[model samples]
Target: MTNMLLAVVVGLTAGAALRPAVVALAIPAGRPADCPACSPRPAGPTVLRLLSSGCENCRGQLLDAPWWLPPAATAAAFAAVAAGDATGWYAAAQYWIAFLGTALLLVDSAVQRLPDALTAPAAVGTLVLLAGAAAEGEPGSLPRAVAVAVAAGVLFTAFALGSMGLGDAKLAVSLGALLGWRSWQAAWAGLVLAFTLGALFAVFLLLVQRRSRKSTLALGPALIIGTLAVLATGP
Candidate 1:
C-alpha cells in the first residue's frame, strides 16, 4: 500500500505537470483571441501561433502550455483508484471526476470566468457517496467524508467571494462530494498549498509586469492541482 501510494503520488505530480499540453491539443489554437501581450492589431495567425507555441506575453494567462493535462489527469486519478482497495468502484469515480473536472475547469475558466463546475460536482459526489456509505459498506463507509467535503466547500466559497470574478460556492459541492467529509481536511490543506503557490505565481507575473493589479488568474487549474496534490500527500 505504501509503495502504491507513492507511485500514485508520483504519477499525479507528473500528470499535473503535463496538463498544459493536453489542453492545447483539445482546444488546438482553434480560434484566435485577444492577447494582452501582442502589439496592437496583431494578425490572427500570429496570435494563434504565439498561443499554440506559447507566447512570452500570454505565458500563464492561458493553460496552452501543458496540453498533456487531460491524459495526465486521467492517469493520476485512475492510478489512485487502482491502487486503493475497492478497485472497480473507486476507479470509476476517479475516472469521471478527472475527466469532467479537468474539462470543466478549462471551459469555465476560459469561457465563464468561473471554475466552479467541476469542483462543485466533486463535492456533491462525495456526499452522495457518503449517503450510500451503508450500501457500499466498510472501506467506503469511513466516517466524516461528507463533513470534510462540506467544510472544504464552505471554506472555498468564502475565498471565492472575497477575491474572484465568480462564485466559488458551487465548486465546494463537487470537491466535498469527491473528497468526502473525512478526507476534506487534506483537501483544504492542499488548497492552501496550491493557493500559496498560485499566489507566488501571480506575484511573479506582477513582479515581471506581465500581470496588472486587475489582471485575473484562473483558479480552477490551481484548485485541481491543489486537490490532486493533497490527495497525493495522504497516506
Candidate 2:
C-alpha cells in the first residue's frame, strides 16, 4: 500500500512537470484563432498558459476545459502507478505514457487537433518500452502488441477516411499497443468503449447543445479515455 501511494504521488508530480511538454509537443506551432495568417507561435508561451491555469490557443482565445480535467489527470497517474507491471522500470514507463496520454486528451479536446509530433513519438516510445519489458517477462505479448497496433491503426485509418480525424488513427497505434499487450479482450474493449462513449457525447451535443453531425467533436479524447479506463482496470 505504501509503495502504491508513493508511486502514485511520484506519478502525479511527474505528470505536473509533463503537462507543459504535452502542450509543447501537441502544438509545436500554436494556432491562434485571431491570427488570420495563423502564424507560428512559440511553445514556451503556450506552456506558460497551460501552467497558469489557462489553455488558450495561439490566438489567445480561452478554450473550454472540462471540470474533470485535473482530477482525471491525477486519477490517470494513480491508475498507471497502481496497475502497471511489477517491474519498476516497466511501471515507470507506463506512468509516463499515461501522463502523455492525459496531455493529448486535453489538447485534442480543446483544439480538435492532435499533432503528429506527439502521437508519432508516443507510438514509437511505447513500442520500444513494451518491447523491452516483454524481453524480460512476456515475450509473446510483444508480437501481439505489434499486430494489434497495426490492426488498430488500419481500422482507425478507415474510420478517419470517413468521419474521424487521422490523428486519432495514429493515436490508436499507441493505445492499441499498450492495452493489447495485455490481451485481445482489453484491446477490443478499449475500441468499443471509445465509440460508445463518443456516440453518447454526440447524442448529448445533438439534444442539449444542438450541434449537428457536421460539427463533429474531437473523438481522440474519448478514445484515449476509454483505453485509459481499461488500462486502469488491469488484466
TM-scores, in order shown? 0.57, 0.77
lDDT scores of the candidates, listed in order:
0.53, 0.70
Error of 1 at 123 (Å): 4.4
Candidate 1: 10-residue stretch with minimal lDDT = 20-29
Report the number of the highest-TM-score candidate. 2
Model 2 weakest lDDT span, ten residues long: 28-37
Model 1, residue 13: what's the lDDT?
A: 63
- Candidate 2 regions exceeding 4 Å error are 22-75, 80-90
lDDT of 2 at 93: 49
Query: What is the alpha-carbon lDDT for the whole of candidate 2?
Result: 0.70
Give the per-residue lDDT of model 1 (tens digit) for 105-181. 55545553443434455555645555555355534434465555556667766776777543455654555455553
Best by lDDT: 2
